[model samples]
Target: MQEILVLYYSHRGSVRALAEMIAQGIDSVPGAAARLRTVPRISAVCEATEPDIPSTGAPYAETQDLEECIGLALGSPTRFGNMAAPMKYFLDNTAGPWLSGALAGKPACVFTSTASQHGGQESTLLSMMTPLLHHGMLLVGLPFSEPDLTRTRSGGSPYGATHWAGKDDNIQLTDEEKRLATALGKRLAETALKLHAR
Candidate 1:
């Protein structure tokens, strides 16, 4: 099966929910599967360390995951109009893969969750795209043709998928949000398959 890495850092479970939805879409495609992985949280104290294995949720991602996957779906919660630090830290450590061009020509999509509707979801998605672009990955985004993109009352975008988790981060994803995210994932997987065929 062709594997698409669903890599994300979800603090309050909202982004995780979106990740799973995207994975579902990826898995819906024949011959494509989702590899769910996450990065460890960064510590402010220099001496603090995280366990090698997380206590819950997906395992910590490795560089090998990037090497192994045919496509990528990157997600993170918004942190002041940018990706969260852990996800950024993980990408910062990807110089090895970048220098080797391991992700070149591979398809990629990005997703984000925000505390408020204006909490910088698009900027966060755009921020995540920078590293993927640097690694030469092809970007896949939801198009206007997706009906949900035109009508989402909560979270969806042409740049990628997004969720408005509210100030308390307790809001469930709207039906439109779910549909658009799934569409984005399907598009990424299909794009990867086509690129591999070339």
Candidate 2:
């Protein structure tokens, strides 16, 4: 089976939820499976470290995960119009993969969640894409042809899937948001399959 790594960091569970939805969509493709992984929180204190295995949720991701996946779906919660530090921390350590061009030509998509409707979801998604682009991966985004993109009143975007978690981070994803996230995942898997066939 072809694997698409679903890598993400979630503080309030919003981005994690979106990642799972995307994973489900990826697995819906006959030959594709989702490999769910997460990064541990980074500490500001000097030389602090997280446990090797997380207490809950997905385990920490390794560089090999990026190299082995047929495609990638990266997700993170917004931190001041950017990706959260934990996800960024993980991506920052991939210099070896970058040097080896391990991710070159692989299809990649991004997703994000925000605390409010205007909480920089699109910007966060764009920021996440920067690294994938640097790795020479092909970007896959939701197109206007997806009915939910035109109709969504919540977190769906042409750039990627998103969720508005509200100030308290309590809001549930809208139906439109869910559909768009699934659509994005399926699109990524399909594109990856086509590229791999070549």
TM-scores for the candidates: 0.98, 0.97
TM-score of 1: 0.98
Candidate number with greatest TM-score:
1
RMSD of 1: 0.8
Question: Could you report the Cα RMSD, in angstroms, for every candidate shown?
Answer: 0.8, 1.1
Off by over 4 Å in 1: none
Deviation (Å) of 143 in candidate 2: 0.8
Question: Quick one: best lDDT, which candidate?
Answer: 1
Worst 10 residues of 2 by lDDT: 166-175
Steric collisions counted per model: 0, 0
Each prediction's whole-model lDDT (CA): 0.94, 0.92
Error of 2 at 178 (Å): 1.0
Candidate 2 per-residue lDDT over residues 134-176, each given as its tens digit: 9999999999999988888779888899998888896477888
